[model samples]
Target: MCNTVKVSPRKLDPEIRTALVDIAARLLAEHGAQALSTRKIAAEAGTSTMAVYTYFGSMSGLVRAMVHEGFARLERQFARVRQTDDPVADMLVLGHAYRHNAKANSHLYAVMFGGQSLAGFSLTEEDRQYGRYTLLTVVGCVTRCIEAGRFRTGDPLLIAHQMWIATHGLVNLELGGYLIDPVDADRCYDTLLSSLIVGVGDDTKASAASMRASRRRRRREVEAEPESVAHRS
Candidate 1:
């Protein structure tokens, strides 16, 4: 009888786990979920195929982990946004941040929102609750707006949900390449946010006037940039 040598599994590393998830996310984005496999992910992550099983248990588990990590990243981005005296402005900033984060992680964003993006993995209730909690940050901002008398009296959660719907729609369209013109996309987003703010009971005239003033200031700044550079030259 011949004695067989069996090698033990490599020790699990948290760093390696994170790298795997990140690489998987990129793969899912670039190649879609159908292309995701232990071999491909391991190759990209520079780890053994067993590493994926060790960390996430299976391909479905890995997809679930990606969804969780995507929300965690969004939560971090939301946490970093600076709160201000103007709740509406703060909400606008948060909305912009949300879009920025989504765009930066478009592949992850696709997995997070597009249920069909992952082949066999469906998001569990816990996964969805985590997503909802992230939305609570927006709800908190809306609550502050209502309390500060900036937004008209209504359910803060409902208003926040409406805002999210509008924002998500715009971001989804832009990410899917439906919104072709960047300038037009930006204008459309700004207009939608302003309209949503106004619909929620903010003074329409004041909001419109503020938007106009903002546009004018941006125009002035754009006009001044070349002159300022020429002066330095």
Candidate 2:
């Protein structure tokens, strides 16, 4: 009788796991949920089907992890916005950061917010709360604005939700190509932000000034990007 050698499964590194998740997200974005499969993701990531099982347990788990990663990335970007004395301007920066994160990770964004694609995955309330935590930073900004008397006295959570509602609507429209011209889109976005700030009881002139400050802050960061990259290298 011949003794047969039994081979153990290969272990997955964190990088490989992340690669699988990214590949899965891209596949979903490019071809929709119907195109997502363990086999396809494995093939795309240059691994076997077992890699998917080893890393994520199942396709649903992979998708769930992908959604969480989407929120995690947004939170990272939000964290990067340095808080300023001017809460309104800081909040504007956070809004711009939100748009940046969504545009940068459109594949992950689709999976994060597209309910139909996640139909059978059954994301729990806790899973959604993971996404909501990113909004807490905005809530803090709103609270500061209220305390400073820059915004009307209101529930910070409600104000933050309204801000999210307005920003998300405009961003979705821009992403859907409804806002055709980039210049027009920027003008429209500035207008929406200004209107939202004014609606919260800030004067029109103050809102416009906050918008300008936010733009200046963003430009400084953009100009610093090359130096930051050099330091990293």
Candidate 3:
């Protein structure tokens, strides 16, 4: 007869789970994806290796969760941009939110976009589907722009994709330090956004005005952030 001992695991703790993910994201950000390991993540998170297995099943799973979290944070930022009378301005704000999320979570950005680090797990069709949901918000904004005649009538999804491509290229470059300083990046971004808006059928002058409105609104939102946090506290 073989004797078997069933070892019971501790109840999964949400705090610990979040900590592990956060630690892994920071490591990925600081040292790139190859730096991630279960033992290293567990040590930094102050939990045992088993905790990672318990919470995320494996290192790949943890990385996958991190990618999802990145998208979730991006969506949250998108949610903050309230729709206004100007769809063009609103769309630009959403683009700014996308860039903000990327810079704020620089570690997870590459992973979310299929970094070389997804060694064990391949993103399934479902994962791709989940990621595309973020674009829907952009599409909706594009649709509004079309309806408002701020943009030429075209496929909203295609327009959104073009916008995303332009925006992501600029942001990825900025994050990689291609653009010298914040001031330079901002200038480049404004230039790129203005060109994109014009390319999509808006007049150059109107595009410039919309960009100014977007900047002013973003500044107001930035100013309100501290008060918003204090109120929550």
Candidate 4:
């Protein structure tokens, strides 16, 4: 008769937990988002599957963690551009930075922008606000150029979309190696951006639009007073 007892599970360190999550993120950045899973991530990190669950709720939660990580990396990349005091120059720098990041992290970029696994993951209100606000940072630069009589003002958001699509298209094409010509991809992107800057940076009517918006806000305020008084009655 031998005394046999079951051995308890190995204890996981906090450092190991962090490493597991980081490995999952790197996997997402190297391969595609689909390649990420609790089993695989834990296997890579040399941790038990239970440890993955203890740290993150599910695979979806892990993907969200990766998404959050990607945004931080993107913001950090854009933060490195030395724009000094010129908005036009700042935006040009940011546009280039966008391309650079997408190129460097193609897999992560696909996860962020492509309609794949991420399609199932709903973006939270914070995500929506972050995307909208970050886009505005560049749009505001364009608006500043317009206000300073540098660029023509139509709609900053619309113009920002143009820039966004332009960079996205180029990066997407380059990522898939779909460029028909043998020319350097980076050079082509630079040329495209330069053309857009010249094309859209000639309007200077933003100040007029701002005045109109201010007046509209004042009118709305005035209109609200009567409505509130009527409601009180």
Q: For candidate 4, write residues 1-233 as lDDT tens digits.
A: 11122221255454554465467766766666666777776666655677666665666666565555556557766655544445565666677677766665554566565323552667677755645656766777778767776677689889998988888788888888899787898578656766777778543343334333433433233222333222210
Better of 1 and 2 by lDDT: 2
Off by over 4 Å in 1: 1-9, 115-119, 180-183, 208-233
Candidate 4 clash pair list: 151-201, 151-203, 152-202, 152-203, 152-204
Deviation of model 3 at 229, angstroms: 7.7
TM-score, candidate number 1 = 0.82
Q: Which stretches of candidate 3 lie over 4 Å from their true place?
A: 1-9, 180-183, 220-233
lDDT of every model, 2 decimals: 0.74, 0.78, 0.77, 0.60
C-alpha root-mean-square deviation, each candidate: 9.6, 6.7, 6.8, 15.7
Estimate TM-scores for all models.
0.82, 0.87, 0.87, 0.70
* Top TM-score hit: 2
Residue-wise C-alpha lDDT for candidate 2, range 1-233, written one tens digit per residue? 11122222286466666667777787888888788888777666666788777776777788789889899978877877888888899988888888887887787888887633562687889889988999899999999999988899999999999999999998898878888654587778778888888898897888888898999987553223434222210
Clashing residue pairs in all predictions, respectively, total 0, 0, 0, 5
The weakest ten consecutive residues by lDDT in model 2 span: 224-233
Candidate 3 local distance difference test against the native = 0.77
Runs of candidate 4 with Cα error greater than 4 angstroms are 1-22, 25-34, 115-120, 203-233
The residue pairs in collision within model 1 are none
User: Which candidate ranks first by lDDT, i.e. highest?
Assistant: 2
Candidate 1, lDDT over the whole model: 0.74
Give the Cα error of residue 179 in candidate 3, in Å.
2.2
Least well predicted 10-residue stretch by lDDT in candidate 3: 1-10
Model 2 TM-score is: 0.87
